[model samples]
Target: MPSPVMPTSRRADGHTSPAAVSAAGLRKSYGDKTVLDGIDLHIPAGSVFALLGPNGAGKTTTVQILSTLITADGGQAQVAGHDLAADPQAVRAAIGVTGQFSAVDGLITGEENMLLMADLHHLTRAEGRRITTELLARFDLLDAAQKPASTYSGGMKRRLDIAMTLVGHPRIIFLDEPTTGLDPRSRHNMWQIIRELVTGGTTVFLTTQYLEEADQLADRIGVLNNGRIAAEGTAEELKRLIPGGHIRLRFTDPAAYRSAASALRETTRDDEALALHIPSDGSQRELRSLLDWLDAAGIEADELTVHTPDLDDVFFALTGPGNVPNQPKESAR
Candidate 1:
């Protein structure tokens, strides 16, 4: 398998470069209720860092604060090498944002939306047209450049939304559920676009309700619960935090199954299926140990399979009781 892409630049000594976004003691509140309670983050440049949490868990609040849409009640933040509080303009210039809703102007042509974004960025008329054409073509909307955005499909409109965000060529992007309402095919396409952005040296800070989206895209993930980050790590590292991982051995011969069960004291047996479930983290050492034990007993059974807790399990364990945001109300169909 190809190795996963590393978003951050590393030094010769193996330490990471300076962070693209950093926050210390970030806090926010509305009226008597606190939304974020002193959270800190250090996201390296050129990496995809996903922040996950249930609805109303302050995920949106955190994004709003970081993106300069709202001020934090307490704490400090820097984005793309600019101090968020002191230089909001600089921060704005260095980052792009695609929120939960589409920003495209449905009444206007797709090309017009891109041009509007270019105009907002102050690109000259010729330059605006150049970049507009470029982005429209890049997003595969070249043929539909003159069509009203309202006429486009959900996926097409989303593609245009992101295309507009890129008009400024910001180094860092904040994607708030970019794939929330997209079809599987569209969502996959968005994933590819995100990967391409990171590959080209852009840093992405993503917030998503989809666990699989985070697993597939984020180099590192942070689980937010109760206004704080409950856990943070690579997908596999996070999976290791939860229990229920195991290796299962199945034997066709009842006698062989019983003999193996006798040798292994710790196992969950299924007599009907002649299978033994051994508790394991599914690590290499455990697999080798099981094989060694079986060889010593001169027992050759049938099949072996390993099972590990997926991100969905980890998300539930850390976030407590909450439904994963349902697929968008509208189907891809």
Candidate 2:
């Protein structure tokens, strides 16, 4: 463990904000297998930072180390203005974690589960009941408050799990694949809940396998591959790093297709489809110029489409093939 230091960072809104979580040269190893290799992170307060990586890429391991569930092999980190190594208790007090699996007790009622969390956090009897009631209402679990958690839907269980994590009112939260088995509607509902949490000024550190989840929720995203970060930036910034943007022009007439193809020399011709794929950045100025060129060349395309690189493209381009070595049987996520 090393002394922690806070670093100033910019949020997605382009405003300077204090770092809620900062780590430098973080490393972790299990036996001969290295999980994290000198990773550095600086997350601003009141923002969502999503960590995207394939399985066995150490996303969970990073979350474990930062949440103080396990000690890092080497690193210095600060969470909520407290030194992570020097004051892990303080760090724990400032953060909440909702892991992949649900923590709700199936045997207990939803309200009882929340009361249990309140008890763990040392809340008084009256205070615990108040908070439990409020959270159940907030998460739409009030109607089923007295119902056994085992009878609750998957979404209700997850909501209860997160509600339990919020019992202490932490400033930072780490959500590891919060919507793993949720339906599309439930997932969207969860997204709204996360948005509401961030809106209230909580910093979120998310580790998710869903690319769309990251793109929709994260202010910034980091892709980890082979025990290292392959790339990190805003979703659009990461998309721009890959080179797949293009304009597709389709002509029903073969003669028109051939003529358009000849006019547009810098294009990949799809003879069978009667289409031409021209490299483009998808900028308005570029599109205008291209349209003008086509007009001048007397070319009329049956269809035109603009294709831009998305998070999926960036994810594939950055995290090539996953190659993780065997680890000890005791190793747990």
Candidate 3:
């Protein structure tokens, strides 16, 4: 077997590289409201880094600052290979953005829309047509190539928007809720495309409202609340930070339930459900301990299932009303 790889403490990538994005003590504000206060982020190359946050929590602001759409009030950031302030042009040239709104114009054909992007990128006419044709087939929009975007479904439009973003061949892409309204199948399709980009050695900085998207795609995820990172880690690492992650033991009979309940003293008993909620992380060590104890006590559970805390728990913990204003939310795309 390949050697078991260890994740960096603050990285989502199984293998680390010099950061693709790095910001330290970043700050931003709109009027009197401080949207960002001393925020810091380090996103490495060739990985999906998800920045999550509640509405009005500065996710857009952060993206804008990093992408050079807006200037920051304080702090410093680096994107791709250039510093944000000193080389905004270089950053722009190296990154592509698919923002919250569908950038695809409904008035134009899908092929035309892509051609427009290619033109904006300064490609020759023949080169523009080639990229447009390639992207149309790549995004599964070949049949709709000649049709106006207004005729496309929500998913189709999103895919086309992302396709247009790639016309420039950017090394880093920012997707701000790219899969906002797609159905399950469409969402998964977009996920596949994002994975393809990363597998081909691209860096993705994503923001969205769906926690499952982050879980499914992010190499690393950071919760941004009140303009600062409340917590950051891989999906498993973030889940491990929350409580109620455990192994559930279900008994077929009241007798078995009672016996198992007594045998596992630390487990919570639910008489009506005939189950024991053993408080533990579903780690191999914990599983072994539970089984060893059950063997020694001559008791058996009819069924056993492992449970882990989801992002919902992490979101509430870090960004609720009572939070210290540095929590992160889950935004997938």
Could you say which candidate leads in lDDT? 2
TM-score of model number 3 = 0.90
Tens digit of per-residue lDDT, candidate 2, span 1-333: 554455678655887778999889899999999999989898999999999998999999999999999999997888888877889998999999999999999998999999999999999999999999999999999999999999999999999999999999999999999999999999999999999999999999999988999999999999999889899999878877977678888889999999988878789999999999899777778889988998998888898888887777777777875623222111110
| lDDT computed for candidate 2 | 0.89
Model 1, position 326, has a per-residue lDDT of: 28
Q: Which parts of model 2 are misplaced by more than 4 Å?
A: 1-6, 11-15, 253-256, 295-298, 322-333
Model 3 steric clash total: 3
Candidate 2: RMSD to truth: 6.9
Stretch of 10 with least lDDT, candidate 3: 324-333
Comparing 1 and 2 by lDDT, which wins? 2
lDDT of 3 by residue, 155-266 (tens): 9999999999999999889999889888999999999999999999999999989999999999889999877899998988988898777688888888878878776668
Worst 10 residues of 2 by lDDT: 324-333
Predictions ranked by lDDT, top down?
Answer: 2, 1, 3
Which candidate do you rate higher for TM-score, 1 or 2?
A: 1
| Every model's TM-score | 0.92, 0.89, 0.90
